[model samples]
Structure formats: C-alpha cells, structure tokens
Target: MATVTFIPAPAPDHTASLRAAVRYGVLGLIVLAVVGSIVATLLAGMPGLYGALLGAAVGGGFILCTALGVLFTAKLPATTAGAVLLGTWLLKMILAITVLAILKPLDFYDKTALVLVIVLSLVIVLGAETYGVLGVKAPYVEPRAAGDAEPGEKDAQ
Candidate 1:
C-alpha cells in the first residue's frame, strides 16, 4: 500500500482581481491608442495623429488612475481610501477641464479624431477591466477551520 498526502491550496489574495483589472485596462488602452493613431493619421495627417495620441492619454489615464488609486489604497482603512479617491477624482476632473480649455483654441489636432478616440478608449478600457476582474477565481465562502464546530453543534469532541 502506498501512503498519500494531501497539500492544501495557497490562500487566495484579495488584490488579485484589482491587479488583473489594472493590467488588462492598460493593455486595452495601449492597443486602442496604437490603432487610433494609425487611423487618425490616415484621416487627417499630422493633426489627426496628434489628436488620437492626446485623446488616448487623457481618456485612458482618467480611468486607469482611478483603478491604480484603488489598488494602492487596498491596505488602508475604508474611510482613508474613500477620502483619497474623492480627492483624486476632484483633481482629475479639474485637470481634464483645464487641459481641454487650453487646447480649445489649438488647431494642431483634429477634433473629430480626438473625440472618437477618447470615447472609444473610455468604453473599451472599462470593458477590458471588467472582464479581467470577473475572470479571476475567488473563493466565495470561508473555509472551515480545524477544531471548529459546525452549525448546531455545541463543541468539537
């Protein structure tokens, strides 16, 4: 007869999903940016190329930054995380608005290309992030501990 030993699986890290999400989001944005740049270049030359690049940076960064903030704050308390997120959100909004306002008068980039890339990047990156997070396998229920009594039982004998 051969003796058998069972090895328990390592505990799952809760941050796995968040990390996966960020990775997918970054990859999606990069692909989208490259495609956008090529298409925009074909459509409007230098201006289109610039527009696509700028749009991708702005839109992708807007969402990616938030995910990163969340990941970084995962070890912190809920209240601290919330406060940091709120502050970051406000800063992003202000920065975005300021950037657009400054670029409003510039004719160096194609507005149509910029708008299209921004919209696409936002949607695609978000979808990719969602997919990544959902794909991660996480334990839904707590494992029973040795020596712990099951429900309805007074104590383990």
Candidate 2:
C-alpha cells in the first residue's frame, strides 16, 4: 500500500520579479542612450559620442552590479536580498567614484555630457525598479479584523 499527497508548487520569487524589471530598465536605458547620443551629435557635435559611451558603460555597470547581487544570493533565502542590495550598492558607489577619478585625468570626453547621460540613465533604471517592485505580490497582507473601528475612534459602550 502507498500513500500520496499533493502539494502546490511554490510561487515565483520576489527576486525573480526584480531581476526581470531590472533587465527591462537596462534595455530602456540603452535605447535612450543611443537615441540621445544621435540627437546630441546634431546639437553638440563631438560630445555626443563620448556621452553615449559613458551612458552605455553606466547602464552595463548597473546590470553587472545587480547580476552580482543575484548570483551571490542564489542559494540563500530571499530574506537576505536586502543585505545583498545594500552591499552591492556600496560597491557600485565606490566603483563610480574610482571610475570618475580615473576618467578625470583624460580630458577626452565632455564632463557635462557624461554626467547628463549618467543621471538620465539612473532615473530610467530607478523608475523601472520601482515599477517592478510595486508590481510584486507580497507574500502576506496584513490581516484585517471585521468591523474594525477607525483609528482614534472609541468602541460604542
């Protein structure tokens, strides 16, 4: 004789949702960078190409940093994603500062263009991330009691 029990499959992970969102964000950023570069070339001549390259690098770096976080946390529980995020963010900041300092000595690119691209890409990526996170279905919702009284309202005697 044998006993059988059925269990439902686990729902998708929050990290997976976030990863997808980030990928979309990165794609958007790349497209924006390319288009912006072409437009810049018309407006400002040579600085546009340099700015495009800088934007591409920044977008790529964001993907790499996010990938590292996901890869490192693959085997760990989802609860630790926050820590991974914080750590990777710190690393990104350090890397950004170092890259800026190194690039400063080489007066090849327009600083204004590079900075503008970076900032614009950052906004796009952040928006994508926010959209992704807000769309996620949280594991649990706060339970509400039936007929709960409003805050600062006393129960009837």
Candidate 3:
C-alpha cells in the first residue's frame, strides 16, 4: 500500500493585498457607473445620474470600510483579530442596508439603474479581490526534489 499526503495551503499575505483589492474595486466601480449612465440614459432616462451617484456611494463606501478593517486588524492582538474582523463585517452590512433603505424610496432617480450598478459593483469588487489576492506569491510551498522521476516512469524505465 502507498501513502498519500497532501500539503497545506499558504498563510496570510501582505498589506499590498488590500491595495490591489481597493485599486481594482475602484476601477470596476467607475466603469460600472459610466456604462450604466449611458445605458440608463438611452433606455429609461429617469434621472439616472443621481441613481448612478447613489450606487457609486454604496460601492465606494463598502470598499473604504473593508480597507479600513483590513488595516485595523493587521495591527491588533492575535486573540482579538477574529472579533474585530467580524464586528467590522457586521457594521458594513448594516450600513449598506441602511443606505439602500434610505435611498430606494426617493423619487429623484431610477431605482433600476441604481440597483443594477450596486449589484454589479459588488460582483466586480468580489472578483477583483479574489483575483488580486490569488496573484500574491505563495512563499511557503517547498521546492520539488531535483531530477525526481515519477513512480510510474521509474517502473517503465
């Protein structure tokens, strides 16, 4: 019988990760707003500029909060790390909901445009963060042995 062992994944990455996340997130949010404005203008055109502004506010607020949370946690004691991060996350959710609730009932803008921009911003920011984080180098994985042949190749030889 042969033993099969699996190696564990890498550990926490650098603070540069937050930079990458926020950079990409902001870029995506900007693109969403521009494209959304054009489309909304051509379609419903129901005071779209304000809606797009509101959506940008929502997305930008989330990104800013997350960046602050990441920075704050990195400086805290290990025992309180989890608690701080969770609390920040809860705060962000509540703030987002409150913003939406307050803005959705307003008659000055198109609700559909605002909703679409907010949803797209969330998706793009998430994708950017995942992509950016994955770009960080994994420094802990040990190098492979030199000239090590596979078991099947050795048997064939």
Candidate 4:
C-alpha cells in the first residue's frame, strides 16, 4: 500500500483575500511596467522610457502600499487596522503631491507618457486587485434556529 499525505488548506479569511490581492496587484504592476516601458519608449524614445518607469513606480507603488498596509495589519484590532490604513492613505497623498511638485519643472521625462502610464497602471492594478479579492471563496456559516435538536440526537419516545 502506498502512503498518502494531505496538506491542509489555508483558512478563507481576510488574510487569504489580502494575499491574493497583493499577489495579483504585483503581477499587474509588473505587466504594466513592461508593456508601458516598451510602448512609451517606442513613442518618445529614452524620455518616454523614463516616464513609464517613473509612472509605474509611483502609481503602482502607491496602491500596492495600501494593500500591504492592510495585509500587515490583518491580525490587529479592527480600529487599529482602520487607523493604520487611513494614516497610510494620508502619507501616500502627501508623497504623491511632493513627487509631482518636484517633477513639474523637470523636462527629462515625457509628461504625456508619464501621465498615460500612470493612469493605465492605476486602472489595471486596481482592477486586478478587485478581481483577486472577488475570487476568494470565503466560508460562510449559517445560524442555527432556537430549539433545534442536537445533531445526531434522538427525540424522546
């Protein structure tokens, strides 16, 4: 007789959903980065290339950071997790503004290419994360009614 080993499945919970979302988000970012780089380069040469890279890093990284924050705080209390997520959101906004301000006067990168790639990255990554989150098979428990007989119990004769 052959011996068989079975691996336990992961729990269907917030962490599982988060892990899926993060995995898909990273995949989306990578795909966007590669395609954006190629397309931008063909459109505007080296400047376009630089723009696409910057856009992918800034846009994708911004959203990815939020997912990571939630994943990191999955085990914490609900209020604490919410607070951390809100804080991260604020920080991301500040960082985005600062980055845009710094890049405003610099002409080394193609602005149009940067904007397009940023928008595309945002849409694609967000869609991918949404898909991932929706794909998880979360377990559901049905509430038992009052006065229900115990499982496997027989009524008195």
* Candidate No. with top TM-score: 1
In candidate 4, stretches whose alpha carbon ends up further than 4 angstroms from where it belongs are 1-10, 140-157
Q: Rank the candidates by TM-score, best first.
A: 1, 4, 3, 2
**Candidate 1 lDDT score at position 48:** 98
| TM-scores of all candidate predictions against the true structure | 0.90, 0.65, 0.69, 0.82
* Model 4 steric clash pairs: none
Give a tens-digit lDDT track for model 3, residues 1-157. Answer: 9999987665555565666766776677777778877887777675787777677668766865776677667667876977888888898899989987887667898887788877777777678776776676645444556698865887896
What local lDDT does model 2 show for residue 88?
86
- Per-residue error (Å), model 1, residue 72: 0.4
* Candidate 1 segments exceeding 4 Å error: 140-144, 149-157
Residue 90 shift from truth in candidate 1, angstroms: 0.7
> What TM-score does candidate 2 reach?
0.65
Pick the lDDT winner. 1
Give the least accurate 10-residue stretch of model 2, judged by summed lDDT.
Answer: 137-146
lDDT of 2 by residue, 1-157 (tens): 8999987556665466657666767676778678778866776678667866786587556654675577567667667877888888998888888888888887667777777777777777667666765776655434445697765677553
Q: Which stretches of candidate 3 lie over 4 Å from their true place?
A: 1-13, 138-157
Displacement of residue 109 (Cα, Å) in model 3 is: 0.8
Q: Write the residue-wise lDDT of candidate 4 on 12-72 in tens digits.
A: 7657778999999999999999999999999999999999999999999999999899899
Report how far residue 52 has shifted in candidate 4, in Å: 0.4
